[model samples]
Target: MSLLVVGSVAYDGIETPFGKVDKILGGSATYISLTSSYFQKNVNLVGVVGKDFSQDDIDLFKSKDIDLQGLQMDESGNTFFWKGKYHYDLNNRDTLDTQLNVFEHFNPKIPESYRDAKFIALGNIEPSLQAKVLEQVNSPDLVVMDTMNFWIEGTLDALKQTLKNVDLLVINDSEARELADEPNLIKSADLIRKMGPDFLIIKKGEHGALLFTDDEIFSAPAYPIVDIFDPTGAGDSFMGGLLGWLSYTNDLSPQNFRRAVIFGSVMASFCVEEFGPDRLRDLTEKEIYDRYREFRELSEIPEVG
Candidate 1:
């Protein structure tokens, strides 16, 4: 089973209490493909970059067995760029600047070969653009989407339309509440389910993630880490790892979903340990599973009153 990812491929400058990095290779699809590559070899990436994005970055994606045939490069413009600074707590950040450049006019064209992909992960992008990718894919078994408050607030109608076409919707806790207009998370999740997706995943940053379906709810806690340099791309990394494991195991059952959440949390913990996408870009499967084992051990506790 192949995984198809659609999102931005950009340059980012980030500042954190730990340090600062300027113009690093950072983007949602980039992180997702790189992290997911550890589990699934055939990852089809669909996004656009610009002339300034560098061939080295493309090569990096190729090294991970990511198929970049669908990744377009606009020779006329520069790739999207974003600058942000993180607070001391590492939980909140402020966007300093954003330059959409080529991404401002991004029109993803899904290749014919990529149409055979069984799993499709639509990273945070315009709802209309995500809809266009879905229309192009031939037969996708599972369609998961990630979105932010920006779309929910600015493009509610489009987001609602896009949600109806997806099987799973992934968003952070704040986005969930903003989208549902409910302060309570559980009720917010319920409202979102009514909007569209059968499965809703509310990512709670360091607290962990919560998965909700009509019949059940499962929660996974984030791994305790000593140091976190930057939290960028952590959510995308988690999504990548979760989807990668699911694709590799060829299991979409509830049991598999539960396990995938743990795998995702493990992957995310590694992502925040370094600046930008450094840690996940070179992650090994052994390392991932080792952390998974550690998480399992830590999570298992004898009956305690």
Candidate 2:
């Protein structure tokens, strides 16, 4: 099975209490492809970069067997760039700068080879663009989306239109509440289901993640860690791990979906321990399974009654 991911490919400058780093290869597709590469080899990336984007970054994806046929480079433009600084808690951050450059006019074109992908992940991007990618896909068995508050508030109509075509929607708890216009999470998810997607995954940074379906609800706790250097790309990494495991097993049942959530949580735990994309880049399959085993062990509880 193959998975298609659509999102940004750009440079980021990040600062934390520990220190700061200059421009680095960072983007939603970059982290997602890296994490997913551990479990699957046929990851098709769909996004645009600019002439300034390094070929070395492309080589990194190539080394992991990520197919870049769908990746486009704009010869005359510069890549998108973002700068941010993390707070002491690390969960909250302040954006220092954002330059959309090429991404300001990004129009993703789904390659012919990517049209038949079994799974499609619409990473955080303009809602209209997300809809365009969905329209391009010939037949995707599972379609999942990730979005932020910016689009939800600024492009409600576009976002709602895109939501109708996706099977799963992943967003942070705050965005979920804002989108649904409900303060309570459960109620927010219920309201969102009315909008479109059948499944909703609300990510609560450091607290945990919650999954809601029409018939069931599953909750998974975040791996408790004392050190969190940077939270960048954690959500995309989680999505990568979740879809990677699901595609690898070829199982879409609720039971398997719950397991995928745990796998995603574990992968995200590793993501926050280091700076931009460091932890995910060098992860091995054995290491991932080891963390999975520990998660299963810790999550299991004997009967209290």
Q: What is residue 50's positional error in candidate 1, in angstroms?
A: 0.7
lDDT of 2 by residue, 1-305 (tens): 99999999889999999989999888898888888878777899999899898877888898899999999888878999999998987878899999999889899999988899999889999999999998888888889999999999899999999999999999999999999899999999999998989988999987789998768999888887888888889999899999888887889899999988988888888988888888877787788989888877766888896
Q: What are the clashing pairs of model 1?
A: none
How many pairs of residues collide in model 2? 0
RMSD of 2: 1.1
RMSD of 1: 1.3
TM-score of every prediction relative to native: 0.97, 0.97
Candidate 1 residue lDDT tens string, 1-305? 99999999999999999999988999899888988888898999999999898878888898888999999989879999999999999888999999999999999999989998899999999999999999999888889999998898899999999999998998999999899999999999999998878888999987889999778999887788878889999999888988888888889899899888888888789989998888976776689889999888877879988
Which residues of candidate 1, in runs, are more than 4 Å off? 303-305
| Whole-model lDDT per candidate | 0.90, 0.89
Residue 38 CA displacement from its true place in model 1, Å: 0.6
Model 1: weakest 10-residue lDDT segment is 276-285
Prediction-by-prediction clash tally: 0, 0
